[model samples]
Target: MHSRLVAVAATAAIALMAPTGALAQDATPMASPVGESLFAELGLPELTITVTDEGIEIDRSDIEAGRYLVTLNNESAEPEVFAGFVQIPEDRTLEDLSYADEVAAGTPIPEEGPAEEDFLWLYETYIAGGPSTVTEAARQVVVNLPAGSYGVWDEDPTSPRLAAALTVTGDPGVRVEGPEPEAAVTIIEEGEGGVGFSFRLDGEFVAGPQVVKVLNASDQPHFVEVSQYPEEITVEQVMATFMFDPSSGATPSPDMLDYERAIFAGWAGTQSPGATQWVIVDVAPGQVLVDCFIPDPLAEFTPHAFEGMLQLFEVAES
Candidate 1:
């Protein structure tokens, strides 16, 4: 199933990138324009929602008005599922917001979780698959205000990470870019025995210059660091350097490794499902290790390498 999804996604991406003559005619219309003065017209401040591997983030401090439009952009290669509502401190809650269009008829009100009353159902769609230029408008429902800090997050118990924020009287023009890249590495799980990880040279074993893109597909935020060790370093020596730790209360000692002078590091402070980072480095015929570190406090105070989040590669003579 996972492989099928990947294949479909790749195909969709290819179709989207195809030239006008080679593209299909059944392509759906992209998202509509968000409107020139969305903030001024709606009496709401401009808002931006950034989806990352760590979670969702809202630029403004609060939501003060009854009506507003929120724009969400997916910067990752996977689809993002948004389901929940904006929370306010008052005794009332807003539950009439819509995505692309109003909520489906008879959609039940969410009765559980942080933003229960403000339940909204938005289907999962690939951000990369949408038209290069797409603008989506979401109807902002009115919620009685009590003047307090409120936040938005995935309502699904399975996904409890916060995605954005709303401040009653905070600045409205704030804009947040996606997370930064800290490191580049691959993760290899070895079942129950243990795991192994390493870096890549040109995405394969052959020597040459390569560009590596690191994606945080996990629920929490993560960081990446690339370091080069001596050329004589062995694979075992390289695995000892990468580390990982989770915020969910899990800690495990990472097996370190050695590398050369060239290193690329990608870090995600709070990587939500759709967060990603990338790095480019050149490698000659030698060995390298790519490491992913996640410090989770709940499960164990350990890095991803301890949990087997590492990928190793060897560059052969060209």
Candidate 2:
């Protein structure tokens, strides 16, 4: 069974966003460069899943069951979340369940426990969140679906729009190449910088229009934002945008977004503790800044990146 969390389709476009469940920290926006670890060669079946707090969008609702490269892209604002998985007992069809109303109202789906069904578990992944856009980019995950009905739900299981039914038909699958992964980068969320949460990368950033994956080694749920610092902005000035500094209450400069110094690379969504997912993205080289924008609920929703969970990498042109 395979399931993907967050991935940006390989491109120079800004991709993926991370939205935490219910909390503001879950919606930290990020941008990052893609490293060519692998994925230059695997050709597997892939599907595009676009989601928001309101509803879910599966490019192809009716598909043959098998192993697939699924891209989970959050194309809305904060608090919106989405995920995919197959369940044995499909209580109802996608039409039987209601979704249009909730999406129209832009209401967030409430979290729900697994439904009362004595069904065997199939391939799945914990829901990942990020509020960027497909126009910007997206991430990837590999999931195996045996011919069966599946549920693609979010944090809110109680939500009418929460669990939608997907019909997977055909024989079982065996392919795992497209989403396995080639290049990898480890993000350590230790408070190394002493300001907030410090980030340490164990690999180098590479450029590509390839499939990708990310592994989170930190306790806090996290995502990757790749961009470049502004010529005039100071790292301290940028960090000030995140937390309540003891020295002074330094907030992020409004000009930061208005001026736009961080050249956008792309973003991936938040991964649950120790879950790895794949994403396809195109990356450009430069002085890249990797950080997590998930807010700390304990600290007035301060972004982890501001607190100190940030690292700088030089993406060499390929």
Whole-model Cα lDDT of every candidate shown, in order: 0.32, 0.45
Task: Assess the local accuracy of residue 60 in candidate 1 as a C-alpha lDDT between 0 and 100.
Answer: 67
Tens-place lDDT per residue, model 2, 1-318, is: 000111111110012222211112323332232123243355767666666656677778777855566555665464334454524354444432334455557755433222212111110232233323321344444545556666565422233444555677765343322245564454444542223666665565666544445665555555656555434344554443433233554564564422233445545555444445555444566555666754443444445655665666665677
In model 1, the worst 10-residue window by lDDT is: 126-135
Question: Residues 1-318, candidate 1, lDDT per residue (tens digit)?
Answer: 111111121111211111111121221222233344223333433345554545655566545532233444444332422322333334422222222112234434233212321221111111110011111222111112223344454322224233345555533333223322222233212222123222223235345433344443444333333223444554444332222223335553433331223333211111223323232334556654444443323333234444454455565676
lDDT of 1 at 53: 49
**Candidate with maximal lDDT:** 2
